[model samples]
Target: MTLTHFTFCSAFILGLMGLTFHRTHLLSALLCLEGTMLSLYLASSLWSSSFVLSTTSITPMLILTFSACEAGTGLSLMVATARTYGNDKLHNLNLLQC
Candidate 1:
């Protein structure tokens, strides 16, 4: 009923949708990762506001920074895989079959 709960639910739904609809492993992974980051941000912000007296603002900033790094790394890997395989489908990545 609270904003935090709503945010978490929304993030969870988005993750589920991403998993169910995305055929490409890379895109699905990115969507899941983004959903996770969004949930974390919302939770952190909620807690920070509720416990403003004791909470540090830097926590959310650190989480954002890590999320950015994760996104960058994931995108780079996706691009590399697409370039090498010419497609981003999960089942098509058979580099080890050779």
Candidate 2:
């Protein structure tokens, strides 16, 4: 199989694993999501012959930083929700209201 094919297949698997483990903890789920993103970045970079420093790579890096910010925001929201509700578990998160 070609390297690109392997890269995409592995990324898909990682994303699935992230979905599967998402119920365990909010932070863990976020990390798994990041792993999926990384796999996607790797796959995308493999598209060209030489993985040079170019605008294509720059966009994904920006996206990764954006995702990092998103994760921080999500964590803060999770903390606030848990503190207000007295539990951080995902099952208990449904009862929260704005």
lDDT of 2 by residue, 12-47 (tens): 697778768677566676667777767766665565
**Which whole-number lDDT from 0 to 100 does residue 86 have in model 1?**
88
Q: Judged by lDDT, which candidate is best?
A: 1
Most TM-score-accurate candidate? 1
State the lDDT of candidate 1 residue by residue for 1-98, as single tens digits. 98768878788788777767785687786878788787888778767776766557778888889999999987888898899888777776666876
What would the TM-score be for candidate 1 when compared with the true structure?
0.73
TM-score of 2: 0.65
Alpha-carbon runs more than 4 Å astray in model 2? 48-55, 95-98
lDDT of 2 at 39: 71
- Model 2 residue 84 CA deviation (Å) reads 2.1
